[model samples]
Target: MTFQDYFPIWDKLDPRQQNQITSRLVFRTVQKGAVLHSGSLDCTGLLLVKTGQLRAYILSDEGREITIYRLFDRDLCLFSAACILRSIQFEVTIEAEKETALWIIPVEAYQSVMAESAPVANYTSELMASRFSEVMWLMEQIMWKSLDKRLAAFLLEETAIEGTRQLKLTHETIANHLGSHREVMTRMLRYFQSEGMVKLSRGMVEILDAAKLEGLRDGL
Candidate 1:
């Protein structure tokens, strides 16, 4: 299917606007672990995922990284096109979590369309707001919740996303996702292992009790 079929707002744009976007859109692919965009450093275009997973994260001056959101198939990402937004000042890293195929709507073309099209501008605002809301939710999770609870939630989330109880994740990788140090995460995982909540193996974690994990996440 064409990108027009994939874009949610394509039907809302006028025929000329549609043609402009269609002509400028480019199809692309990246291997797993590739960096698609690097915030203000690269000023990349808007991305619409055709398949595979993308993780959007922020890196601090000290090199700590934390995920803000993840994009899956059919998901549209606005942060990569931050150059068009103007007000965004933070640097975000967009990386491929799995080998990905996607469409890139060049900023020049999209900006030109947005300048003349109210519908596209409004749709862009809605997308920005939705992404910011996810970032805000993540901030709350980090600020208000304890690490143990967050770890529990993360395990449950990974389980659902991968459709398995065994997660092929190391403590260092999990620490990076949670924005904590590896040693701290190791302590918590050890605690979970002691409680028989998870079975820890080399570079892997197997959830043994879903209800217990749910309870931990619920702060019970």
Candidate 2:
């Protein structure tokens, strides 16, 4: 698919604006675990995912990391171009979670279009609002939800995202997603295993009873 397929406002942009983007758009493939953009200063440009997954996360002063959100196919990531969005002060790190094919719209190109096109500006604002909402939802989960519930929810979400009961994930990776310590996640998984909710082995977690897992996630 071309950039037009991934970008929703393509039809609204005039010929000149479209040309500006088309001229500067870059296509790249990144391997799993590649850091495409790091920190607020990187200003890596707008990321439009053609295929595969990317994770947007924040790190603590103590070096602990937590995922704010993940982008899948056809998703647009605005935070990657933090320099263009002057209101964003905090740092966000974007990494490829799977081998990804994507397009990078140069910040200058995007900014130029956004400056002249009302449709592009409105779409950008909507994207920014949506991302902030996700971050706020994550913050709520971390603040009020217990670790066990959060872990159960995360597992169910992973199953849905990967379309399998068997998840190829390490405990540490899961910990990073939920912003918990590995030892803590291990203990929680052990507890879940004891309850017959999951089966864990080296680098894998298989959900034995998703119904019970869902029940646990909902505090039943």
Candidate 3:
């Protein structure tokens, strides 16, 4: 689908604004594990996913990483083009988790339209608010939630996202997502295994008891 199909507010812009934006929409395909945007200085523009998955994450100065959000098919990522907003200080790294088809709208073109069109401006504000809400939610999870609960939630989420109970992910990979050490993740998984919540083999983790996992996630 084109940008017109992805963005419902396309027709709300005037002909001039539409022409300007249409001229700058660039379609690109990226391989899995490709870093689409890196660092705070890279103004990579706005990314709209056409297919597959994209992960937006923050990397600590010490090289630890935590996923702030993930974009699946049909999701629009405002963080990638956050350079347009003067108030945003942190930059997020965006990577393709699966082979992806995407379209990028240049910041300058989008900003120009947003300047002249109320609909565009309002839509941009709505998108920013939604993304920030997720950031705040993630902050709360990290500050008050335990690793076991967070890990359980993550496994459950991964199971749903990947559509399987068998997760082909390493402890180190899980650690990176939670911003924890691999040793800690290993210990937690071992504990879960002993409790008969999961079965771990090499790089895979198979959920043995979904009920216990859900109950743990809920603090029950």
Among all candidates shown, the one with the greatest lDDT: 2
In model 1, where is the ten-residue run with the lowest total lDDT?
81-90
Cα-based lDDT for every prediction: 0.91, 0.94, 0.90
**Candidate 3 per-residue C-alpha lDDT over 74-148 given as tens digits, one digit per residue, 9 for 90 to 100:** 788877886886677777899999999999999999888888899988888898899889999999999999989
Cα deviation at 72, candidate 3, in Å, is 1.0
Clashes of each: 0, 0, 0
* TM-score for each model: 0.97, 0.99, 0.96
Clashing pairs in 3: none
State candidate 3's TM-score.
0.96
Best by TM-score: 2
Q: List runs of model 3 lying over 4 Å from the truth.
A: none
- Candidate 1, residues 39-99, lDDT tens digits: the string is 7757789999999999999987789889889999999988898788677686989999999
In model 2, what lDDT does residue 214 have?
97
Stretches of candidate 1 exceeding 4 Å from the true structure: none
- In model 2, the Cα lDDT at residue 141 comes to 95
